[model samples]
Target: LEDEAAYDRIASYSPYDNITAKPYPAILAMGGLSDPRVTYWEPAKWIARLRDVASAGPFLCRINMDAGHGGSSGRYKRLEEVALVQAFAIWAVERSAA
Candidate 1:
């Protein structure tokens, strides 16, 4: 991504950079409080920006206090987090369709 054209192309993939007047679909942003790869605030910031810029939103932030980037350390807890994400996805899809 060092080359100017290559970097521009790569950067174009970010949703945050492409925000427009919405009726944009719901956004579920999940982040780990202790994530080493993606800090919790990154999602928070994106959601915040969406809320500010988009015309309408059901944008959500789910910050797992007991987990990191990979989610809960325990198997059951991890499953629960997965279920929550799946449920959210379904709900978002349903809302978008309605």
Candidate 2:
């Protein structure tokens, strides 16, 4: 699938070694437990990979168990998405100051 290929390519180019390296920009990875196109495992695995490399960037992964796909659905659980975005904004602002 295109998603898997894209992720594979990114992982190939991603620096998964060397801590103390230049800090990457904030990474906000979110997944919906019911999403059929992309599994939650993808983000979780990527987070683990980044941690293994000891990345210096802000990496946050969140999952919405009651949601499906990526959207702002009023009928589904969306608090996690909103919280993640807010947190990312704050994090980016603080990091930019440093």
Candidate 3:
């Protein structure tokens, strides 16, 4: 019961519901298209909302078409995902500083 109530209450605080008309830092959202844990639409919809409510943030959504919740199967492939995230973080920082 508490969890259910929390869920209901969270809607008011949700990013989707509480989007402000202010500029925000850039976002890097990545997900797997075939992810069962978190469907691809989750990030896609969030990105759309961010674009609509806040035009200042540069939102980048990367969906791995052939991957699922765990992402790439191999160790090296997983590293690639990490690298991408690192690269994005660096890019965002540099862009913000400039």
lDDT at residue 47 of model 2 (Cα atoms): 70
TM-score of every model?
0.82, 0.64, 0.84
User: What are the per-residue Cα lDDT tens digits for candidate 2 across 1-98?
Assistant: 66998888776766443233455677777788888987878777777767656456667787777667864477434664687688788988898898
Off by over 4 Å in 3: 1-7
Worst 10 residues of 1 by lDDT: 15-24
Question: What TM-score would candidate 3 get against the native?
Answer: 0.84
Better of 1 and 2 by lDDT: 1
- In terms of TM-score, how similar is model 2 to the real structure? 0.64
lDDT of each: 0.85, 0.70, 0.87
Clashing pairs in 3: none
Model 1 per-residue lDDT tens digits across residues 11-87: 78977787776666788899999999999999998898899989556899989997787878788898898899899
Per-model C-alpha RMSD: 2.1, 5.3, 2.4
Backbone Cα, N, C clashes tallied per candidate: 0, 0, 0
> What's the lDDT for residue 42 in model 2?
77
